[model samples]
Target chain A: MTSRGVRHDSMRARNLAVVLAAIHRSGPHTRAALAERTGLTKTTVSSLVADLLEAGAVTEGGAVRGGERGRPGVAVRLSGRRVAALGLEVNIDYLAACVVDLTRTVRLRRTVRADNRNSDPALVLTGLRDLVKETVAQAEAEGLRIAGGALAVPGTVEDGVLRNAPHLGWRDVRVADLVELPFAVDNEANLAALGELWFGCRDADFLYVSGEIGIGAGLVVAGEVFRGTFGLAGELGHVVVAGDGPACRCGGRGCLEVYAGQDALLGALPSVSELVDRLKAGDRQAMETCERAGRALGVALTSAVHLLDPGRIVLGGIYEPLFPWVAGPVAEVLEARLAPMRGAPPSVVVSRIGGDAAVLGAAGLVIQQVIAEPGRMLGL
Target chain B: MTSRGVRHDSMRARNLAVVLAAIHRSGPHTRAALAERTGLTKTTVSSLVADLLEAGAVTEGGAVRGGERGRPGVAVRLSGRRVAALGLEVNIDYLAACVVDLTRTVRLRRTVRADNRNSDPALVLTGLRDLVKETVAQAEAEGLRIAGGALAVPGTVEDGVLRNAPHLGWRDVRVADLVELPFAVDNEANLAALGELWFGCRDADFLYVSGEIGIGAGLVVAGEVFRGTFGLAGELGHVVVAGDGPACRCGGRGCLEVYAGQDALLGALPSVSELVDRLKAGDRQAMETCERAGRALGVALTSAVHLLDPGRIVLGGIYEPLFPWVAGPVAEVLEARLAPMRGAPPSVVVSRIGGDAAVLGAAGLVIQQVIAEPGRMLGL
Candidate 1:
C-alpha cells in the first residue's frame, strides 16, 4: 500500500471531495475560506485543490483582491463547462429535457409532446429515443456538449423495466434500452423529491406530491430522497382514503388519487383548465372543487405525516393553481389530527421549480450519478 | 496510527462482530458453519472465534457428531449465563422487569403494579431502582450475573429522558439518572420493534402496533427499527384518521388512536376488561366493537402500506385479543384497498409474544445494548 493505505486512500478521497464540493458549491474561494467552511487543514485543502486542478475537475481563476500582503491567492473555481449532463422528465402528456453543466446550471432545455396511450414497449422506446435526440440537438445548438443523462419516469421502474405507470397505461417498458445515452431511470416523484432537496427546499425532510392525472409522491428524509426497497415508496395517492369510495385505475378503491387527483377534480368540474381559469377568475364552484380536493389531500397528508412525520409537503403538478385554495384547510385538518409530540402541523408549500421540478430532479440525478465521487466532493 | 486507522478498525470490528453475531444468533456452530453462515473466510472465522473465546464472550461446546468421516469439530457458542442484561417495561399501570442472558434468552421475569401518579423523576427513579435490585436479586438467587439493563417507556424518550408519556402524563423524566444500573431508555414502541426483529419475527419488516390504553406503533424497516428524527417515528396511532372527529388526550382531534385505541374501544363498550372478556366469550357487541376497530386499523394500515410498503404487520397489545376476530376483516379491507404493486397487501399477523411482546421488546433493548458489539448494530 502506498504511504496512504487503502483506508487512508478512501479518507483522502472523501476529504478531497469535501473541499472540491465546497468550492463547486460556494463558487471561487481562497484556501482560508475553504478550510473554514470544510474544517480541513490548510495543507489538506491545498493538496486537494492541486489534485482537482491536475484532474481538470477544478480551475483557478483571477487572484483574490485585498488579501494579506504575503501572497495574492488564486481564486479557485470549479471547471463546470468541462463536463456535461442530460436530464429528462417524463410526464403523462409531455417529455421535458435539460442539458446541465458540471456546476448544475442548466445550459439548454427542450420539450416534446408525448402520447402516453401506447402501452406498446416499442412505441415508448421510440418516444424516448426521439426525445433524447431532440434534447441532444437542443444542447448542441446551444453550444453545450452532452455527457450522460437521467430519465425520470412517472412509474415504478425496476432493473430498467417500467413495472407500472397507471396514468400512462404503460407497463414493463424498457427505459435503459429506449435511451441511447448513459442514463439512469427513477420514479418521477423520487426525482422531484431530489430536485426539492438539491435546489428547492434545501435541508427539509418532507413529502413532494405530484398531483397530476395520476398522483405520486417522493419522501425526503434528512435532506436525501428516501427510496424504499424496490424503489416503490411514496405512492401516497394510491393509499386508500375512502373505504367504499370510487375505484382507481390501478384496481384499488377509495385511493387518494380517486378523490384528489387532477382528473378527479376536473371530473368534479367541467374541464381542468377551465376550473383553473375559474379559480383564477374567483369562481366559487372552482374554489369548492379545489377545497374538496384539499380535504382529500389533507386526509392523505395525515397518513404521510403519521407514517413518516415529514416536516412539510411540497405540492407539484398540473393542478398547482389549486395549492393556494387547498393549503390552509389541509394544514387545519393535519393539525387537528396529529399527535402532540409530532412538532406542529407541516407546511404545505407549492413547488419552487413550478412545472420544472421533475426535470430539475432528473438533472440532479445525472449530476449525482456522474459525480460518483461523493468522497471527492466533500472534504471528509 | 493505533495499529489500524480508526475507520479501518471500525470496519474490522464491524466485520468481526458480523461473524460473531451470526454465530450468536443461530446458536452453537462449528468454524465451517460460522464461515458459511456469516460469509466470512474459514480462516477469518477461526480468528474471530479465537478472539471471542479469549475475550470470554463465547465458550466452546461439544461437537455435533456428523455422518461424515471428517474430524469431529468443536462448536462455539455465546456464554449466555456468563453475562446478564435487564429489561424494564414501564406501562401506565404496571412495571415489568426481565433478566435476559447474553444470547437474548429471558431467564427471569416479574411484574408489579404501577401508576402514572408515581411518574415524578425521583419516584420513577426509586421505583426502577427497587425493581432492578429485586430482579438482580432474583437472578443472583438463580446464580445468574447482571451486566446492564434498559428501560422501555410508553412515551417519547430521548437521551435517556422520557420526553413524553401521554398515558402517564409525564414529560421529560430523566430516566438514566433515576436507574441505579448501567441502563438506557427508549420509546416502548421502538423497543417492541427491536424485539420483533430480534426475537419475534426476526428480520421481518413489520409494524408492531401496541393498542392498550392508547395506541402506538413501531416501524421495522429492512429488519431495523426506523427511529425518525427525535425518535418520533411509528407514532401511527396519533395520525389523524377521522378529521374533526373527537378530542384526544393529546389535544388532537380525530387521531387514529381516538378511533381505535383501547380507550376508544372500551368507551364504546362497558369496560376495558369487559371488552376483552366479552370478545373471548364471543359476545356480539364485543365482536362488533373489534370489527369496527379492525376496519379503522385497516384504514390506517392501508395508509401505512402505501407509505412504507413493509412486508407484514405484527399486531400486539390489547389489540391481540381482537387479532383472531379482526385479522380477516382487516386483511380483507387492506387487500381491497391496496394497489397490487405495493406487494400483495402486507400480511397482517398476530404478535407471537402476545401480551409479553412489550416486556420482551424491553429485554431486546437491553440485549441489543449490552451484549452486541457497537459497530455491528449499524443503522439502529
Candidate 2:
C-alpha cells in the first residue's frame, strides 16, 4: 500500500477501535452518540458502524429516543450471539472451561473435579482438551463462533510454557502444544486480577489476591496486570512473614503460604465450605485457625500495600468464602501497619466474582485483543 | 483547525517526536540513519530535522564519513547550550539546587546546610527561594534559558503541597505557593529513582532505595517511576519487617527505617562520615551496627523483590557511602529470603550517582517533559 493508503487504513482502524470500545464499555449507543463520545465526525461513525454491522461484530438494538427532537436513532451494541471467547483453567484438582460472548455474558461453562496434582502432564492436558472441546461445541451450537481463547495455569507461565506449579507438581509443561487452540497462557492469579478489572470492579489500580493451593497476588496498575521485569511478579505467598517460621514449598522461610495457603487451611479444616460452616456455627478451633491465617495474610499484604499503595485489595479464591471469618484480623494488621500519612488505608474487600475470576479473565484477554485491533478480528 | 488539518498536525508532531527521541537516545546521526531507525522516509526525516533546526533544538555537527558508501551525510545532535533545567531539593538539614543543560551536563550546583527540622514552613520556603534564585542566576549568566524546574521534598507531596515530612517536622506546607517557579513537587526518593534511570544505569526496571533520615524507595518500572494509585508507592521504610522490633516514627513497629534510617545509625555513631570511617577502620560497634542495618534493609527488600520482581536494586543516599560495610549483610539476607523458584536473586548495588540522585532526578523530570513535547518546549 502507498503511504497515504496505509495512513488512511490506520486511522480507520483506530476509529473503529474507539467506537467498539465505547459500545463494549457503556453498552448500546447510537452512531450520533458514539460520534460525540469518540470525537469523530458523524459520517465517520456511521461508516464504521456500517462496517461493524456487516462484519457481524455489532448489531442494531432498540431505538434511542432523542428527547422529542430529531428522528430516533438506532442503538448499536456488540453482537452477543455471533462472536464468543473461550477461557480454560488447569488447577491441581479441577479442569474448567467457560465461553463468554461479546457482551461479557457466559454462554457455556463446565468444571470436572479431578486430582491432577500427581497426574501426568499429558493426561491432564488431554482432560483439559476434552473439556474445552465440549465447551466450544456447546457455544457453536448456541450460534457463537469462538474468536479466541486463553489458558489459566497455577504456575509460572512464559511464552506458552508452564515453568512450574509446585502445588500440581508440574514443570516445563508446553501448554500451547497440548491445548490445540489459538490460546495464550498466563498465571491464574494474573488472570484473576484481569477478570476483576474487566468484570468485577473496573478499578484502575488494585491488588487481587488469589488464595488457591498456594497464595499469589495480581498487581493491577491502570487496568493492566503488572508483570514484573521477569514476568515473575506477584509472588505474595513467598514473602517472608516470619524470620524463623515454617518452610514453604518455594524454599522460603516463614512465607505467607506456610500459614494461609490452601494446604495449611485445609490441614486443620476438612474443606473451605466445612470451615465456613464451622465458623458460622461458632466453632472455637475453626475461628482461631482462620484468625491466625488472616493475620499472616495481613502481615504479607501490609508489605504489599506499602510497596504498591493500591486503592483496594480484592481477596479471591478461598478467601472469598472465608472473608467473614478473616476480614477483621486482616484489617487490624493493615490499619496498624499501613502508613496513616497517606490518606485512608486501602479498602479490603472479598472478590465479587469469587472463583470464576480466572476463567472470566482468561476470556477477557481475548476480548481485550479484539478491542485493541478490531480490524484484525474482523479480517478488514 | 479543520479535522484534516488537525490530523495532519498530529501526524507531524508524532513523527517529530520519533525523530527527536532517536537523536536524544542514540546520540548524533545523519538523516539517512534516523530515517532507517525510525522507519520513516528520508524526505520526512529531512523535513522534521529542518523544523527542529529552525527551533534551535538540533544543530548540525561534523559530516558523517561512511565506509563503502556514497556522499557522506551531515550528522545532527541535540543543541546543548540553548536550554537548561533547574532541580531543587528540600531536606531536613540542607537545601540544594542544580542546573543541567540539554545534554545533561551540570552547569551550576549549590548546597546550603540548615537545620530546617522544626523550622517554620514560611521561613524554610524563604531560604529555599534565595537558594533557587542564586542557582537560576548562575545558569542565566551562562547564557542558558531555564526550560522548567522540579522540587524534590522529603515528604508526602500532593500537587505541590507537602502533606507530611516527619523528618523535617513539616506538614501541610504549600510549597509551590511559597516558592515561585513553574516547578512540580515530588518525594525525594521518587526523584532520586528518576535521576538514576535517566543518568545512571538506564535499567528498565529497578528499585532505587533512598536512605535519608528515614528510609524511602522509588519503584521504577519501564524507565518511569511507578507512583501507585495515590502516588504513595515505594514506602519501603515503613514496610513492617519486624512485628515486635523497634517502633518507627511512621507509627509502624519493626519498620526498615527503625533499623537502617540515617537517624538510627547516627543515634549510635557521631555522623554518617564518622560511621563510614569507623567501619573502614574496623571498629566493632560500627561494623555490627552497619551489618544489622543492612540485614533489616535486606529483609524489607526481599518483600519488595517478591512483590515487584524488579531486575535490579540500587541503594542510594546514605546507604551508598555505607554500601561497602553493608552490602554483604544485605546480600546474605536477600539471597536466603528471596524465593528460589525465580532463577537468581536481583543484583544489589550502590547508586552510581550517590546522594546527588534526587537533585539530578528533579532536573530529569523537566528533561522528560521536554522530550515528550519538544514542540511546546521549542515554541514551535
The parts of candidate 2 lying over 4 Å away from their true place are: A1-8, A63-74, A176-182, B1-6, B63-68, B174-182
Chain B TM-score (model 2 vs. true structure): 0.93
lDDT of 2 by residue, A264-324 (tens): 8877567889888988999998888889999989888888888887889999999999999
Candidate 1 shows a clash count of 9
Per-residue alpha-carbon lDDT of candidate 1 for residues A195-223, written as tens digits (9 for 90 to 100): 87666876457788887777888988765
Native contacts, share recovered per candidate: 0.34, 0.45
In order, how many clashes per candidate? 9, 0
TM-scores, one per candidate: 0.84, 0.92
> CA lDDT of B120 in candidate 1?
67
**Highest TM-score model number:** 2
Predicted complex 2: CAPRI docking category = acceptable
| DockQ of every predicted complex | 0.28, 0.40
